[model samples]
Target: MTKKHYPLFLLMMLIFGMMQVKAQTSLNDIKAILQSPYFEKLYSNTYYSLLDRMRKDGFLPESLTGAYEGMYCRTTGAMVSLLIETSRLKEAELNIKCVLDATTQNDMERIPHVIGIKDNKYTIISDEHQIDGQAHVLLAWARLALKRGHTNFEDKTWPLVSAIMKRTCDRTFFQHGWWSVEPGLVRNISFEHSREGRRWDVWDLLTQSFVGAALNDMATVAERRSETKLAADWRKKMEILQQGIRKNLTTVRNSDTTYLEMRLPDSNGGTPYLGMGWVTLSPVAAQWEGLNHQVMRNTVKAMQQGMLKKTNGLAWMPTDSYPDGTVSNEIIGKGQAWEMEFARTEKDYNRIKAILDLIKIVNAPKPVYMEGGWLDGNGHKQSEKISDTDLAAMNNAVWKTKDAGNGEQCAWWCWAMARLRVAAGLPAEPARVK
Candidate 1:
């Protein structure tokens, strides 16, 4: 068997082992996991750190010293919600103000620019032809508007979002069923696939994920405003996009086992990010097979065997691939791993617990306060603060990390996973109880 196939077998065995055992989580159990001092500290630190970064640097960057402002809002919004849910509403409100402040300072709209706040610190480098940033920008706006009940909500963001979505739909890149960044500008500039780069032509899932999230937010906002027609229209659009996602979904097969493929346009016909099998846990995914008993089991089993790091607790980023299927010389896949976890069923509690355990481990030694923490849009660390205390102690402190530019996009992934687990009938976490 090939090297990849070996892991699949082991994963299958792990799943089998689970089948003979009962899931050990109750609602209180899940809530306890969420409220655990370790997990909460990580959540609070990372959420605010990004805000502090934005205030200090004036623009969120994609990394510690990198410049890419287009994608920070979504992460920012995601973290905002996390702050609110965790009873840190005041901090969340402050971060929202910072982003809005930055937007005004930058003269940015829904198609948020990628440069810095003053004197063009760096030219924004993107294909200059796609909508992940645009979608994320809208997602952030809608999230803030909805959560805060901002009086100027429509007057403030609707126009920008409307124009951007209209432009996005008009793009040939998106119109073409595959949904890609425009070709011929710069390979890997955005998540577009083209022959220009010698790199493997892998489709980026974040684009779709962001778009899906934005649509959901838009629909939610429309519904709240009692704009039934608008809500219905947006919901239909989301459904269409989601349906397309399902129709195109495919899995990678190695020998007798299969792993979910992270990117598409499967340029090499090989599963590069085998670790992405968890993404399928997206409850709202168009092609979700989560309702089926066996399929759910398969996913739970996959988590047990394939992605769970035996020693670290942190989940792997897609298989071994970097951004795309490109053979990176650098081991970019390594890190403390953030708070995101996949949830296909309540039965998958063990997997969730494992993720929480890892969060404890990663945050234990260097936990910071719940203040503005920063990680890029994808939730990897930037130059965020790190202290000497263990994760438990850090839970009570406020972080002051520079904004990595991604505000809450990182938090949204974890938030969605948590909600999904609850939706799957997982019990409430114990700690959330009054």
Candidate 2:
């Protein structure tokens, strides 16, 4: 590198060095990424109109009182808060109140394990549910209450968070931050391929990452505002969780990109999402926003090739799954569009731009407004829309292209879009795909 390029090279080296430290989750890097104009514009525009569409579709009723709607309590709640963050508080408030009232009615039902059935109330906490589902609910309420200075909401939300954590500790096995649940017997599944002697626990990556993040966010908020008495304890717990995540879920760094673990290290040497990058945005965002920003950035860059865009122009981790060698597979990799966008670093903005351009060209994957929210995929490969509306919405969504013949653009996608738009400083021009 030339003398003039020395600073850039050195900066990259410094970020890599930081990721090697003991506590590897970098909160600061995430914050810096979020602050970038590219992210702001992309996120804001993507999310701005999504809330309006969600409200219109009855997915979010004005009643402010309802049931659990399956394990989607978290997605629903998180979307509401994201909407509010992007200046859609009126809509967000309605959704938040609905969740609160629903949870308040039958607190017992809202625990985890409430999957597949949307009774509008709540479900049971079993092995089937992703832990992050519950965490999302807690985070949604906590963020809203804290931001709005609502003491009562904070009070209510904290207990729920604590209860969930305590229950998680009670039900699952936690040793040195490594958690494993006894499948089938514990819930009901074949634990055919667990760690030999260990319980046949189907470790879901999304839950681990999100649960850790939700706790950390809660802790950070607590430390900042000290809104709840549990802030200190929560913060300590968060530190423990972070340590455990790093220990058990050691980051897989390849070339210049990094990825979190989904399952225990497999010998195949392919990506083991096990749900790792499913919520990659959270930890990365936390690191950037938290004190350890540099660590987060370096960690990402060091592992996964730093978010590559295909020659055909789609932002996704390069894999051999597709005939063209681009599509990200859910079973093998869960190569979704949001991951491509969210994983973009400052060094990889061009790649992100290419992917965004493809999305626009396709016109934003239609069937835009549905009963629940965004549809899951563009190709409808996982077309369980009516049966698994939450899953569909959780995975699908876009800005300009709604009807790409895949499925409806849903809430989770909307949330992703809004966040990206906000980061990019773009106009929040709402477009429909259906």
Candidate 3:
């Protein structure tokens, strides 16, 4: 070969070798982050705290540090997801049973948002039925049952599962191919919009996406049990829901790119919401099956372009503001964790590393890992403390937001780290405690 061509060939080989090295380095970097002392301490502390809060009836408080006294079904479902991801199947099942027990206490077939304990008796705290909360709990149960791989597990849970499906599929809840937040229930419009003044009726993307996801998951379980007709029905419902989501809740921007709306206008005269926040990315973050891959990619791209910002030289996403000018933007820990999960799904190792670095930075100042709550854009914790009057006005029980670490935030961060390890070809286990 000529000397000139030989030099070019050698350069090409050098570039290829460097790429290989970078790939290997990326895997090692993820492993080091997972194995770091800070990660181990946070995971261990949070895991034990969750277990400690488990009652005889399997109730676990939403957060030990916050005014979170009752067992919030949505938060409990997320904890169950974390437990299942970390291979704690028995614990996950226990939590699912707790949710089922709470769900059946009413004749309306509606799952209460929060279940509290009074005088050693389980009591319904808030009857504000949330579609996504119900879906999350059901999905967690289905996932745990599937993971157990025992036919009897399915048989034991099928009755409760069927009841939930019956309620969730009821026309009052499932309207127009998408699940609607109950009318006049005064539910939070979205997780990010929880502080916004009361909304009696709303249709949120998180609810729609999660309901579709739950249906798909239940369909898988049904197919596993050879319930072909039921499985087909659920699948068909999911397909219709997906289509409705695309047709009604998506808007075309930049002439060709489609993005999902965070909330849709209700018959009660609510306006359509188009925002770049965590709620807007729920379809992808929830990993709903059969969604258009390009749509998810575009939605994430749009969100990053608009809502993604840096705090303390690390990346994070800010929650949206209320249209009525009640609550403004703030950095939320769980939202950032959700973004990290999406990054891990996309195999964006550099982005994952940046988020991990941010987590370390946020917790470095705290005595212990703090609950996933509000933070300023500058990375300082916001005062989550709620006054008694404010709690009463909101119709909530004592909700003293504590500065100390709690279970929900820890579970989210740990879940992300564990999933990242799995993405890097490691087992789905927490880091060894040092």
User: Could you estimate the TM-score for every candidate?
Assistant: 0.56, 0.57, 0.79
Candidate scoring better on TM-score of 2 and 3: 3
Model 2: lDDT to the true structure? 0.42
Q: For model 2, how does the per-residue alpha-carbon lDDT over 136-209 read when each residue is reduced to its tens digit?
A: 56566556655676455456566655565555433342233223322101111222211121333333334455
Q: Candidate 3's error at 224, in angstroms?
A: 3.7
- Give a tens-digit lDDT track for model 3, residues 85-121: 8787777777877777766654447567888777766
In model 2, where do residues sit more than 4 Å from their true spots?
1-71, 107-109, 112-128, 155-158, 168-205, 220-229, 251-259, 265-282, 285-347, 363-409, 427-434
TM-score of 2: 0.57
Better of 1 and 2 by lDDT: 1
Q: Write the per-residue lDDT of candidate 1 for residues 1-434, one digit (tens) a residue.
A: 89989999999999988976555664557667666666555545544454456543334444433433443444454555455444444555554444455555545543443434446433333324345555655665566667667456466656556556555544333433333332111112254221222243343444555565666777787777776786676566566555544433334333323324344343432233444422344333311231233443454455444433222223422222223322211111111122233343344555556555543443354443211222222222333222212222333332123323233333553444445445544431213211
What TM-score does structure 3 among the candidates reach? 0.79
Better of 2 and 3 by lDDT: 3
**Candidate numbers, best lDDT first, in rank order:** 3, 1, 2
